[model samples]
Target: MTKESTPNDVTLAEPIEQEVEAHSEDNKVSEQEKKKFEKREKERKHLVSKLAQGNMDHLLTRVASVLNHYQETRNSDITLQTRYWEVFQSDIYNGSVIDPKDMYKLERLTSIARARAKIQNEFKMFLADEEVQVSRRSRQETEKEIQLATKPEIPLISMYCDESGKTGNFAIVGSLWVINKARQTQVRDHFSKWKTEKGLSAKDEFHFTEMKKHQLDLYKEFFDEVIKNSDALGFKAVVVDKTKIKRPIDEIIMDLHYQVVHQGIEHEVSNGRLALPRIVNFFKDEEDGQEALYETKLKQHLHSQFRLAFDDQLTLDLFNSVPSFQNVYIQMADLYTGCISRVLNHPKQGEGNHKDHFAEYVLELLRLDLGAKNDQSQDFAMVHFFE
Candidate 1:
């Protein structure tokens, strides 16, 4: 400062000192930035680790709940039971202790168990209600007072016979309801209705033809009604007119026997035996011409194991002993003949027509057979006889 310095020296000295100070400042700022960045990176890593741990815990809890639910719902002997046990054992091996937060998962599982138990209880209640209703209805029927005649030692069996006339166009059905006391009023009233609804008024050919169809329909209707009243009437047996429909009858009989065996109807009867009355068909007469041929073929097709023969004495005796039999026998001789006649008269319709008609007959026969056997035997005694 005392000696006057040169302008160049002064300029050089000032520039060097300022440059050093600026470099020192830049170094300090870089060191501070590095420390801040390292701290932020460490915090991010810690947060990611915590989030990953939480997700893993949540997944494990859900898995445990599902496994517990499966074990509870599955059958005791099922393979799933073993599998769940294995998983539980593995979890215990790894770490038996569960975190307090996982207790909620266990609670969720318990809730599901409670809901399942409630559903089971509701289902049982529903079943009980249904059983109560059935019992009430049965009790009402049993308590009703009605004058029922003492059942004969040998039950009365009636025979209902029917036949089809010329070309199977006309059907004739006859019912012999055997009454031991012979209620003339009941018989007269019933016959009057039957004759009006099913019988041919004029003996003319045309009237007879119409009567045949009417008779068949009426027979079916009557048979169904009698069956419905069988329990109330205390009938021992309900004999269906098998006759030309032996094949159909056999099929129905077999089905009834099957139902009795498989469906527990036998256990419901008085003697643990289903007491479906015996069903038999009249032997077809050879003198019946083509009708006889039809009967023979039908028997062969339906029950090849048995042979058919008409014995007038047997038929007459059976008819007369209706009072000794359980229920009435229904005959569809007229309906069968009429169907045959219709088929023969209309031959141009092709073979399918006969097949269709026969199939329909078989189906109807099956339905009737099943209906008769349904709940008919309480003791299911028929099982021993047939099985």
Candidate 2:
């Protein structure tokens, strides 16, 4: 038997029933949100585990490298880690962040900072245990490597190389070093202007072999301009006497070329003309009919030398071979190398011929008398006769 409800009871039950339904709906929403949060937490933990185990993604690795460089270079007590973490805490949690990406980056970088600190502390402990000796130079080199790997900018110098007398009594490798892009432009402009005045187009390349008696004055003037701009221009040459080579020329030519470039850089660094942490871009005149990739081999040789030579941190960038006719700098290298080769290879043709006169004039300008071996330290120029 059911009792019939009164109107007053119905009104009271209506309000209570609506409240219960609303409460149930709220509980459902809360449960769904909880599941979503749990999934996100699980994913985050997996990501963190991966990062902790040295499975850093590219972004993490890059950020870690950058932080490492800052630690090495910046002398501060607070550290980038502390400053960045404070910002992360204040801005991210407050929801006052400008970009959402900042949230993830700040968190990741802070983690990297922590990891780096831990690794360094452990390394110190390891060194103590092993009684290892780390020289100041080694530490500086490591810092340089970090900077080179992570920094956005670096100082650059261009080296234009050309070979001469490869088949003759003496093989000479000459290179013209231009400091920075501004100097490269300045040199090109000056050379172009001189060529225009001499009724020559951009296509008219300068070569020692092409020099005539009539062009001696022009050639002298050209070299004079070069000497005048000695601050921006440097010349280095390595002359190898073929008589001393026990092996085939091809077997040793690469090394000879490498020595010329390497010693040239060393000389500049020693003289304080070029500073450290520099990259050299090497451009060589194209070799005719050689099956070997000369530029690639030269680049590899240079890399190996830098890797083995503890003293040098100088890096090599673009090692390209281009036509001598296309580049004025390479042509200049050719002219210089050719002059040395002619003087050294054919001693009998010393004074009478135009080539001899021009070579002699160049040697005089360099303040070097023609000899079997000569080196000029003045005016940012060096010529070495390899023993």
Candidate 3:
């Protein structure tokens, strides 16, 4: 058919059809791209969530197992299994994207498992060795008893003393006795009576002036009682921190030693009286001004004290083959003291309130319990391990 050729119609028809087609194709392509992107984003989120869940579960399991093993064996050398160690290294320690093959190295896995097993076996051996030694020591004591006419009782005392301030405050002196049943009862009764008579209550204070007075009163009362009972009970060496003494440190040490001798002679308990000292002193220098410096010093001091007090070498070699005591002596020079000092030095920085919060946060971190929520979560995780 011969159509009438209108100039406007011929110009518009083909291009409009083509333009509509192109626009539709572009929309379709855009929709497809959007779908792909959404799918990938969803997958990424899902994978992250799954990995996080797995990491949490693994960490909980491993920590619980390690803790339980430590409790059962009383060994600090307990280790995690290979698979668990890999999980820790990958998820918790490294915080990296881990591949499937990286998760399983046969040799590494075997080594970790063997290490854990060896640690467990070694701990068991240690316990057995200790028991054997204890039995042998008992036998030796029995053998030695036959040579002596009468056995002399070992005199021991446990003292817990705390000082308030380095220079300005007084010291709180708390003493307890570890003795025969009869003596414990007597001492307990005496303490009760004294508490009632003096109306003494255990209240902690920060003001040096007030603390000093309170400590002085407590010391006086304690000294009087000890003096009165000196004839019946022999005295032992004092346990005290050598920091922040009103008197010179050396003088305090010597005085305590002399008191032990005096008490021994008065009671006529033994011929050779020796002062077995337990002293707590920190390494002080100019570098100990920063927080990190203080932390390092604190750790070093605590470790040294723990080794000296509870480790085998010091107890066995220096103390005439005496077994080490399990209980460790903890110094009272904690972050609370630091806070107080900071408050005293700079009252303008809201130091009084903030310092305590900072100290508490540091303590929480040390305990691996960030807050109450973390503590509860940890307990739940621990329960899972047992199951």
Candidate 4:
């Protein structure tokens, strides 16, 4: 019952031919990819060689933190890679040597947006390793528990900021300045006592527009306290007039924020106000897609304007915190800005909102120059107007 195969039939030759051709195709593709990768590596090495001669201190000293806050998990390779390239370019621009491993890391870090948290963790671990090595060189370490117990935390000037009416004609950034560690706890305790006396929880949130009808008095008391202690604890605001701007809303907002923050920090240092070991400015997380790009840009502008202009001695940390958390300081910014927005935007609202009244009343209380522009550096607040 066996039948002999026909000569025209494929038998094994067609599959064998097809597989050989496929193999050849694969080899061709792999060769091409290898050539492309090599070319890219060569170009990167060339760039790094050129960049190694310049100022590399920014690489070791400057901190780039991304919160991975955009909420989207899908990796955007093109954008991320472009950012990595940007980071690589900056490393060289700052005169840092580009090792193969770091270039590889840059490739990995820039390839996926979700890798932000992982990158930060790895960076932290790297810093920790460096600390261990430095300690080893100086002296032998004790057990892990002992080391952990002895680790000291460096105190910093914490600046909590929030913005309101971002899309409206007026944008305001309000800031609450506080010292970290024990002093912060003391201030929080005082604020909490005021809240408890007003029949509110210490954990209760404070927002002006959403205040209950009876909470008006509580709001007034809090504002008065801020104004009263405006010396020991500080609150400041920078306003932007958007009606005069011709750019898109998002662009305008980012630029104004940068200018406000930039000018604000400079205003502080110029006046001998930023007298702490370091400064950490926390703003609400706004950019979901371009968090890394935006954070890097902001930090660069701050460093360029404030740090480089001086001795690069100042350490500025920019971080993003969720707006709806237990950040009482950010709430302070929101409450302060809410008051400013009401008075500045609704000049015609007769019988002003008490928050607005409090704002204007504070100006009178401090005797700020009514005739002078708000942009003038006052002892308490400095406002920036875009020309």
Candidate 5:
């Protein structure tokens, strides 16, 4: 059982050579020697055949044991010579005794171990690279998800409108579309700051005609800011010639409101700007006379006809209501109508008046013309004069 003291202590290769030498006997060779030689050759061939077929599992187990032993003695971070000297010099194989032949076996095993480790290292590198690639792909996908979640959904469009002049006279309805809530708040805050700083009454309306020189200057500053950021705003104006329509005053006003709404929707649709939910319209809701009744009728008309008019069912309803002076945009709409009515109603009367060409200032601010309608209009705003 002891490896060093075993009867088969001779090397496996040496015994075969010794057997061939012993069977040679005399130079002529005896029959017994021939028979023994033939028998040993048959035994060697049978052992080889058995190993190739049935002992393969046993061979594989030996190969696995050698590979594991080699790995235990070797570290990739160190060279084979450094690893052998550092790690394996004092180690014994399965606690067995060693001989001269065992040294030869160890040298051969070391060569096999080096070859096995090289292939295994390649496999480890492949797996590591694949893991890094997977991590990078996951990071990119997570970044895209974050972008989708954080981006804004949709912006809003606010239409603030007012009518100037009587229903019987040359009336004008002016509307301004504030782009988004931020821009809308920006305008309101600017107006509020100026009004408070100037000590203006909260109840005192923002009527442009009644504004003094200093007030006009304030108005000019606000209008200039809006004009500078005009791309973020849309303005519309419609002047009605009462002489051309024989309808009642209320009826005429309702019709003009309808025209303005229609024009606004058409312009928006043609411009491919229908991403928002609804068009918010805050009109000068006068509660006097039949104005409320006419408004009710107008609402019903728009509700029934909006989709039919513009061929869009996806757009939200037009919010038409009366906003107080507290709403700065409604005040802006009021200012626009008042200025527009002055030019259209009294073209010759303001000829000698020093404040005669105030309409020119209005035009410069709003960039509105009463007649032009372009499908692919380069201008961001529109002014329609309806006779």
Candidate 6:
């Protein structure tokens, strides 16, 4: 049934075979091109992923870009329809092609991505602006410190002190600070002028205990000067309850004095009320009843403490024991501390007398509550009670 091929039949079959071979070669080239395209696409996706790593702002921006591109292309009905048909023709989508519902979701996601990217950019800009502001503030602060450091010498401030009620239920130690030489001169001159006007001699003592009932108005007038000069003056006190003494009162008194002084200076400097590297001149009411070497020991101890706290930056310029009657500022310290001690220990000592009324007046002026410990940041006053 099969016939043998002749020479003419063989020649015709040869062209057909050659055509088949050419078609096969063409298919091989097409397959190679397809592989190359797929590889390029994979590389591009890897590159995008690499660029987006560890940078949320960049990642969000890239996602927004891709979403925006798709949304723009899908906006045209012709392009949308063509892509839809193409997807159906290919096996990439299988039987589940993205429908109108999915396209609507894709649009919503694109809008959200764009919003997120905008917010990320704004937030990044906000953080950058904050860093710049912080840097500027730091520079200004550094310049201020440099200016303070370049002064020829540290500013000298004086502290006058007094203690009262040492033998009573509460021992009160109070101090007044004249922060500069000008303020010191102003306060002393004012006191001297006021005394001269009142027909009082330079040797007259303004002891709170000796004040009579008729002298209440004069005392109030004197205190008015104190309140007026509050800007250049500061006050601090430490009260120790005699009933709670574990250590000797003498030892505790020395430590408490140091505490009040050191803490007051530290607080003022830190709050920008006082500058650093100050020279403090300390003067206390002479303790004639104490041991002969008490003043010397206290001075040594205070200097040692200052050296530890501030090294050589802060210096104890002078330490002396002076008579309270000779110095109006020391008398002022005495009056303030005496009032506080009397109120806390014996509020009824001179009830209905000028002393009681004056004590009440002092309390009102300073805004101090006797029973509760008072220490506030806004005011340069502290009354700490060690129970």
lDDT, each prediction:
0.31, 0.64, 0.32, 0.52, 0.52, 0.64
Local error of candidate 2 at residue 157 (angstroms) = 1.3
| Number of the predicted model whose TM-score against the real structure is largest | 2
Question: How well does model 6 score by local distance difference test?
Answer: 0.64
The per-prediction tally of clashing pairs is 28, 0, 0, 3, 1, 0
Please provide, for model 2 over 296-374, each residue's C-alpha lDDT reduced to its tens digit, 9 standing for 90 to 100: 6767987887667624566665455666663677877887888888888877443468888888888788776557475
lDDT for each residue of candidate 1 in 305-333, tens digit (9 for 90 to 100):
22222222111111111110111222222
The candidate 5 region of ten consecutive residues with least summed lDDT is 48-57
Model 3 C-alpha lDDT per residue in residues 1-387, reported as the tens digit of each score: 998979989888989999999999999999999997687655433322322111223332343333222222212221233224433454433433555676564225355444443333432211323453345245454344333213222233322112222333221121112222224335535644665677654232222222343354453444355445433332222223344345664344333332332232222223322233222111111122335544344344445544754352211111000001111111112222332333333334444343444434423322323222221111101100000
Candidate 2: misplaced stretches above 4 Å?
1-152, 292-294, 310-312, 372-374
User: After aligning candidate 1 to the native by TM-score, how far in Å is the CA of 70 from where it should be?
Assistant: 70
Error of 2 at 362 (Å): 1.0
Model 5 Cα RMSD, Å?
A: 38.2
Which 10 residues in a row give candidate 6 its minimum summed lDDT?
A: 47-56
Looking at candidate 3, the ten consecutive residues that score lowest on lDDT are 378-387
The regions of model 4 sitting more than 4 angstroms off are: 1-155, 179-182, 270-272, 285-311, 353-355, 358-373
Q: What TM-score goes with each of the models?
A: 0.22, 0.59, 0.24, 0.55, 0.51, 0.58
The runs of at least 3 residues in candidate 6 whose Cα sits more than 4 Å from the true structure, single-residue gaps closed, are: 1-151, 349-351, 374-378
Mark the regions of model 1 whose C-alpha exceeds 4 Å error after superposition. Answer: 1-152, 160-191, 197-387
Model 6 RMSD to the real structure? 34.3
Give lDDT tens digits, candidate 4, residues 1-387. Answer: 987778656566788899999999999999999997687655433322212111123332112211121111112323333434443455532324566656555544433433432333433311234453344233234344244333332345556666676656777776666633224545655766777787877458887667665666666667677666555455566776777767666565555555655566676667666653444444552335656676567556656655654444445544444443344566677776676666566563677656556556545544443234356456666656555
Higher-ranked by TM-score: 1 or 5? 5
